[model samples]
Target: MIGCGIGGAAAIIILVVTMAFPGSTTTTSDSSILVDPTKEKQSLFTLARVMIQNTGNIPLTNITIDYGGGAKDFIPTLKSGKTIILSPPDGNSLQFVRVTADGGIDVYKAYREPVAMPGMMGS
Candidate 1:
């Protein structure tokens, strides 16, 4: 009887601790950019939808997005904490993306397909 009570108490304590600290948090930098691609596949032979966010303190200007094979797009300004979604030009493969802007902001990311995971909780 005493062992069962102790075990129950321990389980409760573990549960409380887990609830207190569930997951880790992430913070962005002062001059950072986020480039996220949608998980679903694109139809009509177009590139996947991509999200571009100015996760920075200051506004970005003269932003240029270069999709592979001489395809590109331009954005005059992207204010701080702003997000935009764009699709590459038709006939351009979703191989990679290179972004450049004023103030020496440059980023290059390769496209990768999302994987399916079988689980109740995701990370």
Candidate 2:
């Protein structure tokens, strides 16, 4: 009975935190470039999974991605409809991801706390 009560309280706290802070969201000054990570598959095998879409007619170059620690500069030129996936050095939980394109820069903030997925721990 005591254990059950504690578990219930913990569940409530998790719910509150998840509700207060949502998952990755994008904020950008430019509309040509769209950085979407939610659409990509997030797996433990990779650090970060993101899809960079260039909507403008011109090509995008000198792409830069920055997470909590540092920035990762990509050399490959991005044409229209070309997407790229970036990964952190550690290959794990990323606090946030910031992307800079030719037009402008965009920042995507992650949730404050991580929510556990079903059967991730191999129950």
Candidate 3:
């Protein structure tokens, strides 16, 4: 009976540790353009960063990054398998990002904040 109790306690400890430190997240896509947005906490402020990658066999052209509120940036070309990082305009809270380019390459991604609770899954 004592061994059973010890095993149960150990299981609980492992579960709690797992919940406290979650695993990394990975985004996979078969599309020509991949857009990923993430938020990082720095000091006392949270900053958002976006990563764009070209996965096609050919180069892309006329790329645009729309940050909502009429703020946008453009890229003339992106070589195949190339990646770039973008920051939203100053004083803008990054809720989501939309990327578009010629050849029907369009990708929209939202920033997901991680929230872990006892009975909830982290996002």
Candidate 4:
């Protein structure tokens, strides 16, 4: 099951570190990693899946995610089957929020707005 550190970027990271899945913990800065897709989906807030590999041959628990650029954060989920799902905040302007997991830094740019959906054709 996924643990704490879902919303509110600041306090999230601390909870993640407590898990320490990767055996060793490495602190990451805000400007290190980056995520794609500038907007969130309607049925779902965010469709971004982050793959965190504990290359050190250990399990890293207590993972956390922080969003910089002042954008709100989302609920945290485990990377099941190597893919972790993320839900976005209520606001429309994500404004390129940053991410920090298990002390690993990352940046995500969610679309300000969604694009046209399918079935618009033949109208």
Candidate 5:
């Protein structure tokens, strides 16, 4: 009877410790950029930063970008970078986004038309 109680206590402790933090778990970075949904002024325009990470073991290409809710506005290719940005849309575009290497995509609702930039403004 005393041996049974001891075994139970040992099992409970082992279970708690292992369940606290699983050994085989994988962690990922925040890896996200948040921006306001309002339109940016041309006078206050800057290049939005975009991060391009390999993420996977192999390289990827033909990343598509679409904005204003149109798949036709996608970029054919995008490379890995630390920051990516674009000016607000010209018309009724709801979101802007970039595609990931695994065919996954991310979109943003920031305000920028013609993809505002410091030097590219009023071009």
Candidate 6:
């Protein structure tokens, strides 16, 4: 009746006021760098030549490059328009590469299929 309606309205107002304040939320800044990877084939092995380019106006430092999950390395710094090349253990053998820059991260994946030779059968 009248008492029940007043109680429900008071509860709803209290709930709305409780939700109006900011609580456990957080904010993060993210950024990225440019990366290029090329495949190199040797007599018996293949290699990946990666070029990391800093295109942003800010100078990127303490950059990390992860070649799949097997290997990782760090670069001291990369100024704008600067580039660095990296050769993984084996060219094109790794399926993924991850680069962590100043405030952002980038992941690159390569999926390659072998082309059939003149007389090569299925696969």
RMSD for each of the candidates: 9.2, 9.3, 9.1, 17.4, 13.7, 15.5
User: What C-alpha lDDT values do all the predictions have?
Assistant: 0.71, 0.58, 0.74, 0.39, 0.41, 0.62
Task: Work out the TM-score per prediction.
Answer: 0.63, 0.51, 0.64, 0.34, 0.31, 0.56
Q: 56-77, model 3: which lDDT tens digit per residue?
A: 7778789998988888989999
Query: Which scores better on TM-score, 3 or 4?
Result: 3
Off by over 4 Å in 4: 1-60, 68-81, 108-117, 120-123
Give the 10-residue window scoring lowest on summed lDDT in candidate 1: 20-29
Backbone clashes (count) for model 5: 18
| Per-residue alpha-carbon lDDT of candidate 4 for residues 12-122, written as tens digits (9 for 90 to 100) | 676666443222223343212223333434453444333333333233344454444354444343332233435444543444444454444333433344344576422
Q: Candidate 6: which stretches are off by over 4 Å? A: 1-32, 90-92, 111-123
TM-score of 1: 0.63
Candidate 1, residue 65: Cα displacement in angstroms equals 0.1
| By TM-score: ranked, best first | 3, 1, 6, 2, 4, 5
Q: What are the runs in model 5 whose C-alpha is more than 4 Å off?
A: 1-38, 41-58, 82-84, 87-89, 94-123
| Candidate closer to the true structure by lDDT (higher is better), 1 or 6 | 1
What is the lDDT, from 0 to 100, of the residue 62 in candidate 1?
94
True-structure Cα RMSD, model 1: 9.2
Q: What is the lDDT of residue 64 in candidate 5?
A: 43
lDDT of 5 by residue, 1-123 (tens): 999999999999999886553322111242322222333344555333223333332334454444445533333444433333444344544444434323433444333334445676554
For model 1, state the Cα shift of residue 116 in Å.
Answer: 4.3
**Sorted by lDDT, highest first, which candidate order results?**
3, 1, 6, 2, 5, 4
Q: Write the per-residue lDDT of candidate 1 for residues 1-123, one digit (tens) a residue.
A: 999999999999999886553321112345667776543453433337667888888888898889879988999999999999998776667777888887777777766555435652231
User: TM-score for model 5?
Assistant: 0.31
